[model samples]
Target: MKELEERIRREGAILSETVLKVDSFLNHQVDTELALATGREFARVFEGEKITKVLTIEASGIQFAMAAGIALGVPFVYAKKKKAVTQSDKVYVAPVHSFTRGETYQVSVDQRYLNAGDRVLIVDDFLATGAALVGLVDIVEESGAELVGVGCIIEKSFQEGRGLLEAKGVRIHSLARIAAMKPGEVQFIEESGNRQLIEERA
Candidate 1:
């Protein structure tokens, strides 16, 4: 994770107090090696849990979820941003507002992919607004899958996303937790706090 923090400090662009762009390496054009490392970290953190599947939202989160699935040796599933013509009618849906995109969309997952017997680990690229993560959590609840926890590549710790998920009893782990950020500076939360984060696992 220190490596991730270093990359962010060097390459991340902070447009404002609320916007941080990392598409250069983390998202749009990904660093394959680092992405795979993130997967291994999540697997190690959540080890011993009988994780049956890894879940994520479509587009950005796919790679990380796939990576985690590989590390955990389980299959992965992703919720489509919009329902496809071929998608099943019997699917769980939730409304998610993309703060960056400034719009909302209904994300859906096929009912057959998730069920009571599954233990799910929801993965994502960032945890800022928590809207998307919340939607995915709702779908997981609707499907009756036990949500082991959420794994995010990066997190804006100053945001409400963490509080919102914590209120719902969701455990979260983020590789780089930014306590604050501005146009030229980024502040990360101390690693000393992660022991509590890992211990609070559900």
Candidate 2:
């Protein structure tokens, strides 16, 4: 987690008070070593949960979920943002609003990949609005699977995502939590109580 915090400080771009762009490393051009390390960290955090499968939304969440799956020795499933011809009719569906893209879309997962007997851990790239993640949780509930918890790579702590998920009694673990951010500056919620400065503007 320390390494992750360091990366954010060094490479993350503070676009605004609300948008912190980490595409250069975390999402777009990913660092394989960091991704695996994040998976191992999540595995360590949720060690005794007996997680059977890892779930995530497609695209950005896929890599982290796959990493988590490998660490946990389980398969991973991703919900498609749009229903495709290859998808079956018997799928769990939920609505999600993407604040970034300014649109709402239906996300779905095939029923065969999930069921009442499995325990699920949801993983994602960012935990900001909680929209996509909330949709995944709804699908998991509809499938009758046990919700283990959620693991996130980066979390905008100033946002309502964590609060919303917590209201549903979901446990969340985020490697890097941003307390606040603005152009050329960023602040992190220090889980270790050290309160380290991530970045500061000149």
Which structure among the candidates has the greatest lDDT?
1
Clashing pairs in 1: none
Q: Model 1, residue 57: what's the lDDT?
A: 92
Give lDDT for model 1. Answer: 0.92
Q: Each model's C-alpha lDDT?
A: 0.92, 0.91
lDDT by residue (tens digit), candidate 1, 1-202 = 9999999999999999979999988889999989999999999999999999999998999999999999999999999997788989999999999877899999999999999999999999999879999999999999999999999999988788988899999999999998878899998877678434423432
* lDDT (Cα, tens digit) per residue for candidate 2, span 1-202: 8999999999999988998889988889999889999999999999999999999998999999999999999999999998898989999999999898899999999999999999999999999989999999899999999999999999988788887898999999999998889888887888775333332320
What residue pairs clash in candidate 2, if any at all? none
Q: How many residue pairs of model 1 clash at the backbone?
A: 0
Of candidate 1, the 10-residue stretch with the lowest lDDT total is 193-202
In candidate 1, which residue ranges exceed 4 Å CA deviation?
194-202
Could you report the Cα RMSD, in angstroms, for every candidate shown?
3.7, 3.7
Per-candidate TM equals 0.94, 0.94
